[model samples]
Target: MFELTAALIVFLFPLAYSPGPGNMFFAANGARFGFAATLPASVGYHVATLLVTLAIGFGFETTLQRSPILFQVIKWAGSAYVLYLAWKLFRAHAIDKVGEARPAGMWGGAVLLLLNPKAYVIIALMFSQFLEVAASSGEVIAVGWISSVFTLNNLVAFTVWTLVGGQIAGLFRDEAQAHLLNRVFGSVLALVALWMMFG
Candidate 1:
């Protein structure tokens, strides 16, 4: 159990903190909106993360393993959604613009997590690596610990990235600079989507 807990911390710390679509989206929204405005989406994303983690821990991995095509479909769908987000970010007007340039909301964040191929894969891997079949009680306890760790780590990571984005926004006070930064984020998001689809 100690070994499992240590391994989970080592593995999940980097995975949760690393640059990913979810983190990037939060950062972008934080910049476009503000940290306070991004909270609802953050909450939604973490809720989805917890639910997905629980699902994977409780035998959903077998279901996924049996249906490779389902994985492919999800990958494609997730990629498409990411691309759509990229397009939206790319076309985002000045932050000061009053109409139609709103930041992503709670549902947007939840949907992003629901469609995130990486999130599914990571959760599956975590369970496969840490869960034991015979030790039912221990497994349940481990899963509870894992879920808590994952949620806490994700909250910290997302908040830090959001703060960074807000700082970046401060740096890019000029409308043109902000626009350019938004386009850069859009391009990065597109690249991430492509990587998800093909890598």
Candidate 2:
């Protein structure tokens, strides 16, 4: 149990907080919209995260391992969807005021997490690293506890990124500055999508 707790903090922290498609999307949304408007999507994303973590901890990883082609299909589909999001961000016009831009809704957030290849990989890794085989009771407890910790950590990391985006938006008072920021974030998202496809 101690080992599992330590692993969750040591491994999951970097995994959840590091720059990735989900985090980047939240940041972009925060910059485009505002923190208040981004809550629904954030909630949806974290809920999906919890579900995925539980699924993997409960043995979904074996199913995924047996079907490599299925994983590939998911990777490609998710990459394509992320590319579409990047295109939207790239083409978005700067709003005169914050929170005026249309934000991705709860459904979009759910879909993003459902198809996110990185999320799958991270959950699988967490379970593989932390779950024990000898004790069923301990395993059950660890699953629940670890899943909760992962979900909570994810919520915090994403919210921080969102707030960072909001701060960036606040800084870019001029239309041209905001426009440039959007283009940069959009390009970064596109690159992340490409990495998902080939990396």
Question: Which candidate's lDDT is highest?
Answer: 2
lDDT by residue (1-199, candidate 1, tens digit) is 5666677778888887787888888888888787998998888888888888887877787888899898898888988999999999888866666787776777888888888878889888877776663255576776777777777778899999999888888777678987998898888889889988998
Alpha carbon deviation, residue 27, candidate 2 (Å): 0.6
Model 2, span 1-199: residue lDDT tens: 5665676788877776888998999999998888998898988888888888888888888998999998998899999999999998887777455453578888888888888887889888777766763146576777888888888988999999999999988887688888888898899999989988998
RMSD in angstroms between candidate 1 and the native structure over all alpha carbons: 2.0
TM-score of 1: 0.92
Candidate 1 segments whose C-alpha is farther than 4 A from its true place: 1-6, 133-137
lDDT (C-alpha) at residue 89 in model 2? 87
**lDDT at 2, model 1:** 66
- TM-score of every model versus the real structure: 0.92, 0.92
- Write out the backbone clash pairs for model 2: none
Q: How accurate is candidate 2 locally (lDDT)?
A: 0.84
